[model samples]
Each structure stands twice: as C-alpha cells, then as structure tokens.
Target: MPLMRPRMATARLTPSRRPHPVTAAGAKPAAASTMGGTLRALSLLAVLAAAILATGCSTAQIEQLKHSRTGIASGERVVILARQHHSTHEAELDFVECVGNALSRGANGLEIASHSDFVNGLYPWFEPAIAPLNPEELPALLARPGVAERLAETGVRYVVWMDGMTERVDGGGSLSCAAGPGGAGCFGLAWWETDARYEAAVWDLKHVDQAGLISADVTGRSVIPAVIVPLPFISRPQANACRGLAQQLQEFLVVEDQLTR
Candidate 1:
C-alpha cells in the first residue's frame, strides 16, 4: 500500500505534425512557374541579340577611310574600276556601277564618271592594258607615260578599284530534279547560305597613293521546300553586297552634313 501511493501517472506522447502532401505539391507548381519565367527571360534576350546582329553589317572595314566634315571637293572627279583577274566576275562590274550611281546621287555635286565611259570613251586603247592591273600594279600603271595624262584629261582625281565575289559558303539538305510528261522541275527540302565579299581600294590619282580601303561582306540564307509543289526563296546575296558597298562608298565620299543638306 505504501509503495502504491508513490506511483505517478505517465504522460501520453503525441506525434509531431508534418507538412501535407497537397501543400508540397502546391509548392512544386510555384517553383516550376519561377523556372518558366526565367527561361522565358533568357529566350527574349537571345531574340534581341539576334535582331541587332541581323540589322547591321556582318563585316565592315571603315578605319582606312578618312573622316572629314568637308568631304571630296565638288569639282573633283572620281572613277570606279573593277580589278581584272581570273577570279574577277561580272558581278564586280555591277557593283562598280552601283557604287558610281550612289556616289553620283550622294557626293554633293562631285563628278562620278561611269565605268563604261572611262573604259569605252576616255582611253579605249589602253583598256586592255589597264583592265588587267591588280592592286599592287596600280601605282606603276599610274606612273606610266600618258596614263596619268589620260586620267588627268578625263579629270579623274580618285580611282576606286572593286574586286570580290559572292559564293555559296554553305549548303545542306536534299534536292532532286526530274523530268516527265509534266516538265522538268526540282523538288526537295534544301537550304543554302551565301557570303558576298568585296574590297574597295580608293586611290588618289592626284597624289599617287591609296587614300583608303573599304571592305564589305554580307551573308544570307534561303530555304527551298518541295512536296509535289516547289517553293524557293531568294537569298539575294549579290544585291545585299551591292547595296552595302554603294552605301559605304557614299559615306566615304560625302560628309554627314553634306548628305543632310
């Protein structure tokens, strides 16, 4: 009886509470939402970077060009010529014409002689000799007797030599061509990329030295798909090159203020 009086009641133990599975599941969705937002932000940044790159020139060389508030003189005459070589193609001639026309319009009254006029009209006899002159031989050609005199007679103060070509840099996918009662046609899924590269050497005939060198390069890609019907897209790399070269020539020949005026 005495020992039983000292017996004390034992306290009941309770289990600790834990997080609900539903609550854990809810937290997962919130984490996923945050991750989704981060991914979207990253994607947006990539698109913006690509857009900036696409709008501007892929490759440009303008450091050799002179930056002046007062550009070429109004009465000074300029001629655009194509460097002759085995690699020289007809596109260079077109580029020359494009640059000449652009300079004529933007050079603030400077005389821009057409390539044909210089070749066909001024010194037709020397065309064969001068047409083959490379960049290195330009100085020697200018020093030759009657060469400088002829250019002077025509009033050509600056001679710009354009040389380069546009070529398919990369191509992939499959293309197949076939002929039948319908007609000859090509069908496939294909894509190709091209690069247009050219350099302009501006020679100061009056000073007998190179004034500047302007190089421009443009790259473009196109895709063609055919499933019974064919659809082809034009990359127009040469056209892009022409526009870029002409614009650069314009900027080189004219000052910013002159263009606005």
Candidate 2:
C-alpha cells in the first residue's frame, strides 16, 4: 500500500460573550436578600426559556478532512487509541469507547479492536509511555520489523488517535447554600458553560501513512437557580461531543453507508 499524506481541517463554534455584573460589597442584608430573590425568579424563567429554545439547537460542529482515497476496505480491522496524555480523564476514555462502539455498529462493518486488548497484546512492542503516536511518528514506528509483525498478527490495518479535552470556558452568577435546624436550602443563581474539543487522526498502517484528521467541538451551558428551591439545568456537553465525533468518524472512514459488491 502506498503512503497517503494526511489531511487536516478545523472547525470552531464561537460563544457569544456577555459582561457579568460585578458583585459589590457593603450591600445591606435586606436589600441583598430581596435582590437575590428577584434574580432567582428571573434566572429560573431564563433557564426554562433557554431550555425550550436550545431543544432545537445543536452544539456540535465538525470540520471534515480532505485526503486521497484510502485503499481501506469495508470490514477492515481498526483500533482506536487515546493519547497517553489524554488517558488521565475518564471522560476522554468514555469518548473513545463511544467512537469505537459506533464504528463497530456503523454500516462500514469495521471490526473495532478493544483498546485494552490492543495494548496488552501489542505489549512492550508499542509501549504505553510512547504510544498514541502522532502522524509523523507513526510511519517509522510501523516500519520496524517487530512492530510490523505484531500489527499484522493483530490484524489491525488502521489506527485512530484521539486527543483533546472538555473544559469549563465561562461561568457567572453565584449561589449560596445553608443548613438550618429544619432543613437545608440553597439560594441565588449560578451558571457555567463548557466546551468539548477533540481531534481524531487516522493512520493507515498498511500504507504506513496518515489517512486524515477529524475535529469536533461541542459547547453547552448549564444553569442553576434557587428560589427557595434549587432548579438544576444540565448541558450534557460531553454527550453531544461524543455523538458528533462518532458520526464524523463514520463519515470520514466512509463507513456510514454499506458497501455494495
């Protein structure tokens, strides 16, 4: 198989920024209580409205990679790997697992290799400390006779490297909580937004070159308001990101539609 140069592209969703009001000190207890109550009511209304409006909105975005035709065939064996640096996050592992499961179930009929199995079987040949190889490093690593034999024995043709993280980008508002003899209570309003960004690089081991790169970004906001009662709104940014990345991987690998003989 002839080596194919990798193609890369990026897509981003820019969040609209709004200035947050600075909390001021020396506010009277009565005035503060009144203001907090009013803000809580308004925040509750805003959360409800936003939830309804956001039902029709999607937070995921994908930038497709352009590359020459990969000689990959349907039902090919593929392994999904999370960068060693990214392996620290449980969410990252979950994302990779989602992608692998989706690929296995997609029309492409790809055989998704288990990450644990791949790591264990490949063993010292592909050290974990050195694993999650970048595109440039893959060719040389795969070119080694022992590594090549191990990969062949494992029947893995393509390797997908996933790296990135989701983080809280912006936050505002404040919520206070207290416990009384009667019960516990939380008051005021609080909210935060998160952005999930990840990139998948496809390496064709047979060709000893990178196939392409797929990038997905998902941003979502969650709001919580307390009006004697705490109302929590969840954004589910990680879930959205997982779905988007999985779908893009299916399309990028041309596995979305079944191949007809």
Candidate 3:
C-alpha cells in the first residue's frame, strides 16, 4: 500500500533575510547611511535569489523544509538522514550517530540504521564544491535497482535529514587599561577564548518506508548549536544539544498532532 503523506500545515515559515551583523559603529553618519543602503540592497538581492531557486522545484524540495520529524504515529519506523556542506564525511557521520542515539533513548517506535548506508540525496541546495550531491538527483538514485529493497532489508521507514555547519573559530582576547595618579597604569591583559561554534540545521524531513513515499508533512528548518570547548571542556557538547533539540521537536509534534500527520 502507498504510504499517505501528512496533510500540509497552514503555517509556513519563510526564510529570514536579516543580516548577521549591523553596520559598525564609530563611522560617520554619512557612512552609516551608505551602509544601511548597502544592507538593504543586499537583502533585496538575497530575496531575489531565493525566489529564483524556488521557482521550479516541487513542494518537498522548495518550501516544505521537513526538517525535524516528531510526533510521528505510534509504531512508525524511522530512519535518520545526515548531510554536510563543506565538511568532512567523519563530521557528517558523527552527527548521524548523535541523532540516532538521541532518538533511540527518547523516541518510541523508532529504529536506527547504519550511518554508512544513509541517504545522501545530491540536491542542489548542497554546496557543490564542498559536498557534491544534489537532491534533484535522488529519484534516479533511488530508482537504480535494489535501493529500496536494500532499505527494506534494514526495515527503514521515516527519514530525519540533517545538515551540519563548520565555521572558523575566532579566538578572542581582552585587554585591560586603567588610569593611575602620576602616569596612566595601563596593563594589557589577554583573555583567550574560542569563537568557534558548531550547530546542526535540520533541512529536510520525510517519512519513507518499505511501502514507498509518504505525503510531505511538516516543513520548516531547525537549528541545534554545536559545542566548542576549551581544553578541559568536553570535546563534543553538541550531542547533548542535539538530544535536547530532538526532545523539543518531539514535544512540538505532540502539541501539533492535529496539524501534522
């Protein structure tokens, strides 16, 4: 029997175009005005780019993000999908395991599969130079004989698609200066800190089983902050974050049971 996709929700989340940083202070008023104008221009360009990219894609590939899948029906089999852009395969696999572990501990009626055999839909959204796979090419890949049969052998069902990000950590240091009686007693005190933060952004969610594709249900994106610790801190704090976020997502689905499939 063909799996039924979840009903589409009325609420949709449009991507934000807000700039991460505001114009630097200490600039002249005129310069600030110019900067604001530049920011606005960039924002418009971004909107246009998104519109173009979204024009021809299907609902699943475009607006229906389907990131975090929670509140699934009882006994629904589940599979985790992990992808990365410009990051090591090791990193991607680590994230997949983290997700699987979290779900296994908390979620019921779910099963974990091998990370090595997980889905890698080569969709266009992925940055080509770094991680070369396009989602558009997924159907063909799936059709390449024996794919679904193999997945059925594993008893795979739902998919939890994850995207990981790696950014350069900017180490920070602060200096202290004070005034004294005779001469200014200014001392440079450096406090070192790492600005590197890792986070997983859930980009796609789909419920696929041995029966076949289900209707695209939830659509939206979610973020889980990664952990970057100094020497004495835990190496991968992101695991806890992932578990927390997953639990939160599960709660969200429970609340929206009426709205989601």
RMSD of each: 25.9, 8.3, 15.4
* Residue-level lDDT for 229 in candidate 2: 52
The 10-residue segment with the lowest total lDDT in model 1: 1-10
lDDT of each model, Cα atoms only? 0.57, 0.66, 0.36
Q: How far is candidate 1 from the true structure (C-alpha RMSD, Å)?
A: 25.9
Write the number of the candidate with greater lDDT, choosing between 1 and 3: 1
Best prediction by TM-score: 2
lDDT of 2 at 64: 55
Q: Write the per-residue lDDT of candidate 2 for residues 48-154, one digit (tens) a residue.
A: 45543443233667665634345456446789887765455524787888878877784654688888888887776456577635667776676666877778777
TM-score of 1: 0.59
Q: Report, for all candidates in order, the number of backbone clashes.
A: 0, 0, 8
Every model's TM-score: 0.59, 0.71, 0.41
lDDT score, candidate 1, position 138? 64
Which ranges in model 1 have alpha carbons more than 4 Å from their true place? 1-70, 87-91, 106-110, 120-145, 176-187, 256-261
| Candidate 3 lDDT trough over 10 residues, lowest sum | 224-233
